[model samples]
Target: MTTQQAETDDSDGAHEERPAAIETIRSRRSGHNFDAEAELDDETLEELIRDAALAPSSYNLQPWEFVSVQDDNALDEIVELAYGQEHIAEAGTAILVVGHSEPETADEVFQQWADAGRMDEAAAEETKATAVGMYDDDRMGRDYGIRNPSLAAQNLLLSAHARGLTATPMIGFDHDGLAEFLDLPEDKIPVMLVAVGPSGGEEPERLPRRDVDEILHRESY
Candidate 1:
């Protein structure tokens, strides 16, 4: 990803700098209008997914998976599945953020932690056992599955924005149809779909946000 230079205001003879990460978050807009001709190459998409995978997860299980749809035929099918949201086709690439409903990676993750000296062998094994036990309940496993992947989805949007690309997160698709199309295993659940590409026309104004006082709660809601 390219680094964005901080903006300076010479008119006031003052220098005000903001972190690129903050700037990317503040400037990101959900855009559906995209340049159909503009293409997102494989390398760039892979980088974005890598950044997204850095999002934190419960027990660090990192149960998220991504399905990238870039082929013309696949995009067309996605548009249909999404109830004819043409932007899925226009963007030229759509990422399906999926979550695994089982802590299948716990063994490998804890083993690595022990090997890296982050945890003693006993402690790592104990922690892994606890995590596995908690997720053994079907409801808890499903909740964590969806929750963690949603975090990755947000990171993906920010990653795309940081790279000077436009992205729109959508959840309007038919879940069963998407699952069938992707041929996902029963343990995997579709969480969100994000369309990523360059803007085609003038971007709409940023919508108003709720005031901090209205949304923020102190110790309790």
Candidate 2:
């Protein structure tokens, strides 16, 4: 990561320096090639997942799980489930971002909130009831399941970049096969597959993106 900093003024008329995370966000690229021989140590892998888990979730439901594939046999299976995506095998690690369709931990989370004094008992119970009712609906539950984990996936990519690793998020996969391979429960869904490792020494040119003017709308689109 670069040591360069950007400066900005805050509301209190004090200057605050922007974090290197901005550079990480700007420079992060989706890697298509990775060094096949490279490997990620357990500590680094754990840290990556820790950073990903910090992503925000609706009602703090935190409905995401990860499966890290590093063993040769597991990688081989993942490659097949990912439709022969060679990068999955080449990368040092592959992470399966799993999402839960229901807020199964609502009771525990709300109890903690009340215990920590963040919320009164009555408020916590009411909030939990509302969240449960909304998530009980099939469509809403599914959407939250996928959407919340996607946020974590993005965080994972950025964390990898900050650690000087190349990572790619791929959606092209056999979802049913993956679920079967992982033996996921009915409520758990495979949201995304990410491969992480050192670069293969050949970097692709950055692709163009739409300019701010083209993509941005004032108040209404």
Candidate 3:
């Protein structure tokens, strides 16, 4: 096993040894059933979304877009698309995670980071201009959406877990049907569904990780 993998295994055991960050990691688990009595307040959901949006992307392309299905009609609609997952309908929030490669509002992507003070006007404008340059570049344009969007989804899931809520990242739905149901234009591809709500059970089990030896390499694959 590689050092990182060893550390991960040790960390699993180390949760009992360490109490701060490890504890948070240990404490956060995917919630299956949730408390229907409590719903996600708007502010908290926005905060969770803000944290999730901090996820990194290639060239700052930031291709993730979410459709928050909070209304009963939408929830019912998503349940059918999600292959009839019961928790998906019951969860307080369901984010239809989409990978949008060519957004009509690319400026908004950089504008967000700048609005958060992560970049100044000069830097944001520079970045935004540079972003436009690569719009037609196949390597950066098309694939950036796929690569960055998946990472952002992970960020959203982890952030949701950190906020004392449970989340399930599901791709077991009908993608084409979902796209049709959402009435998305060509720019949007429904990649996954994230269901979030209060935990109604014990900490869920972690899926076993492949050893680092298998996943990592020093120079070449």
Candidate 4:
């Protein structure tokens, strides 16, 4: 979509400015309250989801699925499922992002990696063979379920930002209720809810962040 940006002090401050990627990172904020009237176009929405699909996941499983709420009546119904998160109602659209690790998806992805020459052939074959084979093995089963989908969600958020759209990553919603509302199959697990729309007022104030020195360590904390 439209790349036209109303210039701002933080963005126009310096000529030798931060790289776009770094700038996007520094400026990104979690938008909660938004103008419900500001809508996104179909072309822009498609690009946003495509960019999200670029995120990396364990085994390239890409286990995430999304239901984009378009109908006003449907959005109102889904908002109720989220326990009346006002933002969900206020947003132009809310995406029900679900995580599912069906053996079939994992198998399909693993095979693609092998065929694409990105992964070692023998290793891919072995991973493919053992992937679903290990589904019942206890150790790997639980691990893959979380690892693949979390990466996918992160990709979605960043893509939303890059597209000039803002989003909220919400864990506060009721998952079981949302699944029933969306009629999601039992195989798909709801992980997170994302509300996508345009700016409401000012961009959200940046919350405080921990310094790397405090959060990370060279070898030990």
Candidate 5:
């Protein structure tokens, strides 16, 4: 991951900037059109993925997987699955964010912590036991499966924006169709579709936002 350094402009009219992290989050918009000819390199994509994977998860279970579809032929099929969303076809890459509910992954997660000296063998064993016990319940497992991936998807969007790439989260697709199209494993669930690329032109007009006064509540409702 690249560390974003603050840069100062020499012009007299320059203003102090927000931290890069804050600026990136504030600047993100739902981009609908993309320059199809512009291609994203694998290294940049990997960096974005790494950054996204750092999102918090329950017990560090990290159940999500990101699949990038960049081929024209593959994208054509995705367009169909996405109900013919033109952006899917025009965007340089379509990222499938997938997650699964398997408790087996917990073992690996705990083992990694043990190997890294973050936890001793006894602690790792205890954590594994607790994680497996909780996730063995069908309802709890299903909740973690969906909830953790959604958090990771947000991280991916923010990371893409921070990297100077435009991305849009799409939830309008046929989920089963996308699963089959992507040949996703039966254990996995499709969380969201993100289309990333350079903008086709100027971004669309900014939409309105609700003021904090509309959402904030003092103490309690």
Candidate 6:
């Protein structure tokens, strides 16, 4: 096994020897049921999201936004959009990951750089222009819009896992219905739904993975 893969295995009874980060990741499982009485307040949810926002994005633009679904009415709507998945409303919170494909993010980022003395106003303006030009292109904008949000979603899942919370990243939902439910702007795109809460029972059996040799290519396929 590779060093990372070896570190991920705890079957040898060296659980305490593994790094905390790896242990958190290896132990995390997608929870199907949550303790309804267990609650995650807005402050705690925001704290988790703060760490998730630190996830890397192209140009450090941080193109994602999260909507914490806590209200019963909103949760019901999301459950409908998600094809009546009971877990949608059962989790303490369902964070919607949305990505922006507009020049507005570039404007905000460049302006911040200028304010922080990281770049001169002129340089910031030039950089914004270049970035806006690239993001204005249909394919590139769509690619970044989807990919950046996905990165944030993964970060959120890991962050929640680290915080002793169970989370599931779900993509099986009606995208257009969710967009309408969230009242997203034209430039915003819904990318993922993350259900998070305190652990409920019924952890599924861990599935076997392909051998490293089968997946790792020497140089190229």
**Against the true structure, whose lDDT is highest?**
1
Superposed on all Cα atoms, model 5 deviates from the true structure by an RMSD in Å of 4.0
Locate the minimum summed-lDDT window of 10 residues in model 2: 2-11
Cα error of candidate 6 at position 211, Å: 2.8
lDDT of candidate 1 over 1-221, digit per residue (tens) = 44555654334755456677766876788988899999998899999999999999987899999999999999999999999999899999999999989999999899988999999999999999999998889999999999999999999999988788889999999999999999999889999999999878778886778777899999999
Which lDDT tens digits does candidate 4 get at residues 26-104?
Answer: 5577887677887878887777777777878666667677778877888788777777877876878888767764665
Residue ranges of candidate 6 with Cα displaced over 4 Å: 1-16, 114-123
TM-score of each: 0.92, 0.91, 0.75, 0.83, 0.88, 0.87
- The pairs that clash in candidate 1 are none
lDDT of 5 by residue, 1-221 (tens): 33344543333745555577766776688788688889888998898789889999988888899999999999999988898898987887999998877775887899999999999999999989988888778888878888898898899899888777888999899999999988898888898999988777778777777777898999997
Root-mean-square deviation per candidate: 3.2, 5.0, 5.5, 4.0, 4.0, 3.6
Q: What does candidate 6 score on TM?
A: 0.87
lDDT of 2 by residue, 139-199 (tens): 9999999999999999999999888888999999999998888888978999999999877
**What is the clash tally of candidate 1?**
0
Query: How does model 2 score by TM-score?
Result: 0.91
lDDT of 6 at 94: 90
Q: What lDDT is reached at residue 8 by model 5?
A: 38
* Candidate 5 residue pairs in backbone clash: none
lDDT of 1: 0.90
Each prediction's Cα lDDT score?
Answer: 0.90, 0.88, 0.74, 0.73, 0.84, 0.83
Off by over 4 Å in 3: 1-27, 103-140
After aligning candidate 6 to the native by TM-score, how far in Å is the CA of 186 from where it should be? 1.7
- Model 5 has how many clashing residue pairs? 0
RMSD of 2: 5.0
